[model samples]
Target: MKVAGRCGEGSEGMVRVARGPRSAAMPHLVRGMHRVLLALTACGVVAFAGPARADELTGTLKKIHDDGVVVLGVREASIPFSYFDGKRTVGYSQAIAMQIVDEIRKTLGMTQLRVHEITVTSSNRTPMLLNNQIDLECGSTTHTVERENVAAFSDSFFQYAVRMITRKNSGITDFRDLAGKPVVTTAGTSDERLLRSLNTEKQLNMRIMSARDHQEAFSAMKDGRAVAFVMDEPIVYGFKATDPHPDDFIVTGTPLGYEVYACMFRKGDESFRALVNRVIVRSQTSGDAERLYRQWFTQPIPPRGINVNFPLSEQNRALFAHPNDHALD
Candidate 1:
């Protein structure tokens, strides 16, 4: 069945072995025809939108619905996607996750459904879900075949190019410039793996320092321990913005690879997966997705009230025009 906007294929992409895991500033035409190309893309998941049946609840939905609570996996500083704004979980992805939670509440007919949060990192997000510690991981998680081999991912929301950032005087404008220099990326991430492959494939032999998180990766670059910090473009831009001297850093390099970001959960549970996808499609079609993007990416955001100042790219505009579940690997 053609269910929603530009739909993606089934989990036919990379999944990182252990694996894991848009906004709206939208346009007027996108606003009007947002629900145009959605189709049933994933192999078996359906987009059924009927009312939730308590007696028939299953999987994650059943556990949360029966328990009257939903657990969220949040990030410490993934910037516009999922991050702590000092006090609360706030970001574009976090907003989308909350929308999903609201749908859960409505579907289960539990208005006062209690919601809780757990901090998850690149290393622990999957284990937390597989271990049933958190119901949904809402952050900048990429959907890949290896990861999908173990856990499950929702439909794609953001697509980005993996790149690196460095000081203006670092003389590293591209991947070729970092031969044997120390470069940092968050551990347990696709970016780290990609960098590793590039180091060997291109014979760069650069020292790869895998930090525990983006903050630490940025710190390595900032303190001159690492000449460059490799990460997704949007994330590195956010990191660049966080710098006291944003002008000192520039996000540059040829796009080594492309990937899609999606919400993650345990494998199986097609019903709950369908619910999550439906919420994302609705956001895309109803313009909630675009609004969220504008709010987080284009406008000023929390913590330091800094504006990422990143505009919606045309490629991303297409994703919003037609949402998909496909992964880039």
Candidate 2:
């Protein structure tokens, strides 16, 4: 008698085995056993009959199930995207992350799920996610193809242009004017990458300085250590609105580039990524995301009563209309 066994890719592939003739009841027993084993494998309880591979069924969802906690990686001062509000973390991304947590709880059939918050800067956020130090990164992280190679990103929640913030009287109105000037950007950020590319391509001779985070970069600009601070336009607007002398600074120049902001997680986890995408899509289609956008962009936020007053751009509207995880060019 011969029986076919189904398997998945890799070691989990299906196989067929033949056995000598046996009692009529043997067929039923073999079939029953096969069904049970298949069920176990489907549940991620059993792998191929050998040493289990280390890469099997490990990701954000599995970790949440095992630990009963989901850690959120938040930024200290990415402004209305993610930021510290007094001792509490609050912002657009933070709010969206909480919604995801709620969905996770319901999906897992847990009455309560403990959430742990970890503050992450641009320099550490990616490594932290890769190391499983944080289950979800709810910050103003750009979704670039290079980054997507290492991490998974949800559909873009926000789109921003790369621009520079300089003193109004600095005579740096465009990217061309930045030649030979010292500019600061957050270390380990897309801003740094764009600036470097611009410097090399345009032969701008810009003196580039790296700050550990956005606040430090802004301070460098404030203290004259850097003639300009280059970052995402929304972030620049956030800092400018909160600055003591808002009129003293200006965000100028043609946009260097546009960035799509999305929540990040470790790669190779389709289930977890699908869950995150579902939540994001629902928010966009249900008007929930738009409400949050207005809450953060139009209304005043914490640390100070300041509003970025940024309306949703048409590009973002198109993104929400057809949510996708593809990196924008």
Task: After superposing candidate 2 on the true structure, give the runs of residues whose Cα lies further than 4 Å from its correct spot.
Answer: 1-58
lDDT of 2 by residue, 1-329 (tens): 22223334422212123454567765887977975675454333474433223345356776887798999999999898899978799999999999899878865766588999999999999998888889999789999999978888988888889999999999889999989989999999988999999999999999999999999999999999999999999999999998988999999989988889999998788778867876887678657788999999999888788988889889888887767788865
Task: Report lDDT (Cα) of residue 249, candidate 1.
Answer: 92
Predicted structure 1, TM vs. truth: 0.85
Inter-residue clash pairs, candidate 2:
7-14, 8-12
lDDT of 2 at 188: 98
* Per-candidate RMSD, Å: 9.8, 10.5
lDDT score of residue 83 within candidate 2: 91
Error of 2 at 235 (Å): 0.4
Best by lDDT: 1
| TM-scores for the candidates | 0.85, 0.82
Clashes of each: 21, 2
